[model samples]
Target: MYLADGLVPYTEVFSVLDWWKVAGTRYPTLRKVARDIFAIPVTTVASESAFSTSGRILSEHRSRLTPDMVEVLMCSQDWLRNKCKGEQIM
Candidate 1:
């Protein structure tokens, strides 16, 4: 049924969420999945900047650290930061 549906007109201000809401009855399973997927917050940060921790984590004194160790440190930092935020919210 979705495949046969016509595309939304360019002039119309159509929202994916709005369409899902109206079509929820027709596509209950898909509507649930779409809701969960769309619930994730959007990020505007560039991938390069978001993943690069080299400047902050790497310095002259820390240059000796292996790549594997650097990766572990980066993962630990992110986990701790997220854990702290979760604690504060509760």
Candidate 2:
């Protein structure tokens, strides 16, 4: 019951003896067989929607951006992303 109800994707992963290696570092029986297991190349960006919000918040051209502007941009981003769902993304 524990295995069935306690876990979802991790359980699916652990079913394989190879992936079970992630659970315990001491267990030398299993190695990292799932090297390129990630469906996406990167996990952090995949978890997010778009970098447009980031772009308005940060500038690569200049390093003198103020912290207050960054904060306001972040707040606007969170609000728009969460509340303005039906609006056209342009």
- The candidate 1 region of ten consecutive residues with least summed lDDT is 81-90
Per-residue lDDT over 14-53 for candidate 1, one digit per residue giving the tens place of the 0 to 100 score: 7876777788888788788878988899999897676567
Q: For residue 12, what is the lDDT in candidate 1?
A: 60
lDDT of 2: 0.54
Leading candidate by TM-score = 1
- For the record, the alpha-carbon RMSD of candidate 2 to the native fold, in angstroms, is 11.6
Residue-level lDDT for 6 in candidate 2: 41
All candidates' lDDT scores? 0.77, 0.54
Reference-based TM-score of each model: 0.41, 0.29
With candidate 1 superimposed using the best TM-score fit, by how many Å does residue 63's alpha carbon deviate from the native? 22
Off by over 4 Å in 2: 1-59, 86-90
